[model samples]
Structures are given as structure tokens and as C-alpha cells.
Target: MKRQLVLVALTICAVLPVAQAQKVGETVATPFQGFAHSAKGSQLRDQVNDLVALVRAKRLSDAERKAIELQEKFEASFDRKMRQYSFQSKEEYLEFKQSAPEQFEWIDWGYKETLQMKAFIAADKREFPTALSILATIEKIAPASAGTAAERGYILNQLGQPENALAAYKKALSLSTRYQSQRPFQAAALRGIGFALIELSKLDEAEAVFNDSLKIEPANKVALNELAYIRDLRAKR
Candidate 1:
């Protein structure tokens, strides 16, 4: 049973990066035609499009390499455009947020997506600390973001900090309830909480959490497999 649990951990560590990369592609690999049609921002749009293509092509290592360079470029360009707005005070920025929601969304989404790519790249490299740091920045930028908190839980779990991971997963669950758009994220967060409970040796609690996750996502393979493992553990006792 212990050996099987260890294998489950190893399998999760191996599969998660690929799954996350696919999610990143799905989230960001949309057509960029309307995003930045002007010549001034066309280069940035092209770069993003190319990166998305690379990810979709399964050239993730190459994509990760390109993403590092693109991160620097995007930050500089975004900063320049942000400077052009010249919000001199908090009130000015808040008013802009309210008055130009589309513009705010464009800038915010671009920056957050860029950071998310970097975070996934770092996670692929097994750089949990770096991934967590990037996610922390993302959380600050998008305070109510869903995946940011959940991904932090993933990194913390990879780093073998189950207690902290549990807290992060619960935070993700809490935030997810306030937003109904991403049911998969909420389900994933619940699975994360179950995994953390297992790590803490709270097998019974983990079983219940896994059942809860399965309730949300009946097709969640990870939760189903873990629940089976939990059952095996109990059957032996």
C-alpha cells in the first residue's frame, strides 16, 4: 500500500506539468486578431501567437525557452504602454479601471497570462520555488484569480509542504465558490486538498475529500485512483 501511494505521488509529479501546459495553451492560445490589431502592438501579438503555436505543437521545451525571452520583452513593452497612461494617483488608476474596463482587461490578461506561462515553464523544470514566486506575483496582480492560488498549492505540494499546500488549496476552494465560471478549477482544488490530506497522514479525511472531488468531477481520474488507494489502505486494516 505504501509503495502504491509512492507511485501515485510519482505519477502525479510526472503528469501534472504536461496537464498544466495543455491548460495554459487552452487558456491563452486563442486568435489574436482583435487583441492588438494596430501596427504598434502587432509585434507583441505575433510573438504571443507564435508561442501559443509552439505550445500547441508540443514543442514545450522550446516554448519554455522562448517564453523566458518573451517575458522580458513583454514586461518592458507593457511598462512603456502603462507609462503612457500616466495614472499619477490611486484615484486615477481606479477611475481608469472603471471607465476603461476593456483596456484594463487587455493589459491585465496579457501580463497575467505571460506570468502563468513562466510559472508553468518553471514547474516543468521542477523549480517549485520559482513557480511559486511567479504565482505569488500573479495573485497580487489578479487578487481574485482562481488558478493562481490552486497552482500555488501544486507547487507547495511538490516542495513537500503538505500543511501549507492544504491552506493554499482551501484558499483556492474559497475563492472558487465566489466564481462559477471554472468548475474544473474548483474540482482540481478539491483534489489538491485531498492529496494534501493524504500527505498529512489523515487518510480518512483524505478519502472524504476525494469523494467530494469526485462528486464535483465524476471523471476525475486522479481523485478516483486516490480513492481506490484509500480504500485499499482501509481494507488492509
Candidate 2:
């Protein structure tokens, strides 16, 4: 009986790191609202949706190609718009952004969303290095994005770097607190922290964090499943 219990506990721990990996699809399916009002934006949105469909259909190679093409197309569109403004230099563009924040806001949001989709696709393919590189670009473009931090946490967790994942998840939670638009991701960040804690053999803390996640999103299947696993493990202990 003792040996059986130990084996069961070991199995649970072995599977803990991957509890959230399958949730990546739901993250990828999240729609971008930045470009919803314009015709070009609508086209870009459809392209992103197509990419998501490909990913969901398990066509990672197609998704990767589509992601690359979308990035190039978006860059071309951005450049065309910038040319219309006749900005002489990066400094001029920065000044214009500050002077006409409203005009620049949607563009910033669209660019960030496009980069985020690319990162999500890379992550879905289990291309951690590529995903991290794309996320770095997103960080440079939008440092305050809780979504980026949450993604970093998820990738780090998959890399078996629980300590780093914990920090990234914490940063995501902090950013979510400050950014109203990011609040929706708080439950996910909490769940990430819980998963990282589990990998670190901190089950008590992990249980608490998972509970917190459940409080935010009562229907979160990941959190519910993890909480059950924790209880089963503890009972065996």
C-alpha cells in the first residue's frame, strides 16, 4: 500500500507541469478588438482567425507560414500609413504619436495583437525559443501588457523553469491590477503561479493559488482539475 501510494504521488507530480499546456488553444482563440472598425483591420482580423483555425486543426506548419505572411503584410500596411504622414525619422514618428495619441492608439494595439498571435502560434508548435523571441518583441512594443507576461510564464513553465515562471506570473498579476483591459487575464496568471508552485513542490501554496484562480473564474477547468489533483495527492501523502 505504501509503495502504491508513493507511485501515485509521483505520477501526479510528473503530470503537473503539463496541466495547463492544453489551455494554449483557448488563449490563441481569443479575438483581437483593436482593428475591428476598419475594412483593412477587418481583413487582418479574418486572417488572424484563419491562422487560429489552422492551429486548432493541428496544421502548425500552415499556421507558421500564415503567421509570417501576416507579419509582413501588417508591416507593409503600417509603413504605408507612416509614409502618408511623411515622418522623417523615428523621432518624428514618436513626436507625432505623442501629439496625436488617438490616431496612433489603434495602430499600437493592432501591432501588439499581431505580434501576440505570432507568439501564440510559435508556442502552440512547441517552439519555445521562437515564442520567447517573438514575446521579446512584444515586450519592447508594449511593456505593460499582462498578456505578454502571462504568456512568458506559460512558456517558462513548459521549459521546466518554475522559478522564472513564478516571477513572470507575478508580474502578469501586478500588471493586470494596474491595467483595466488586462484584468481578464488575472485568473490565468493565478493558475500559472499555481502550476509553477506545484513544480517547485510547494503544494500548499499551489493549492491556495489555485483556489484564488477559481475565485476569479469559478468555471476554470484547469484550476478545478488541478485542485482535485492536489487534494488527491495530499490524501495519498
How does each model score on TM-score? 0.68, 0.67
Please write out the lDDT profile of model 2 over residues 1-237, one tens digit for every residue: 111111111112112221132132122122222222432333565565566566556676786788688777766666444322221123323545676634532333344555666777677667889989988787655665677888888888878899998998899889767655556567878888888888898999999998998898899777878877787778888
Please report the TM-score between candidate 1 and the true structure.
0.68
Worst 10 residues of 2 by lDDT: 1-10
Global lDDT of model 2: 0.62
- CA-RMSD of model 2: 9.8
Error of 2 at 12 (Å): 25
After superposition on all C-alphas, the RMSD of every candidate to the true structure, in Å, is 7.2, 9.8
Off by over 4 Å in 1: 1-49, 79-106
lDDT of 1 at 97: 64
The TM-score of predicted model 2 comes to 0.67
Local accuracy by lDDT, each model: 0.61, 0.62
Give the per-residue lDDT of model 1 (tens digit) for 1-237.
432221121122223342243243243223332432321333554565566556556677887887777767756655443332321123323545676535532332434555666776677678888888888887766554556778888788878899998998888788666544223367778888988898898998998888887787798667878888778877888
Residue range with the least summed lDDT across 10 consecutive positions in model 1: 3-12
Q: Give the clash count for model 2.
A: 0
Model 1, global lDDT: 0.61
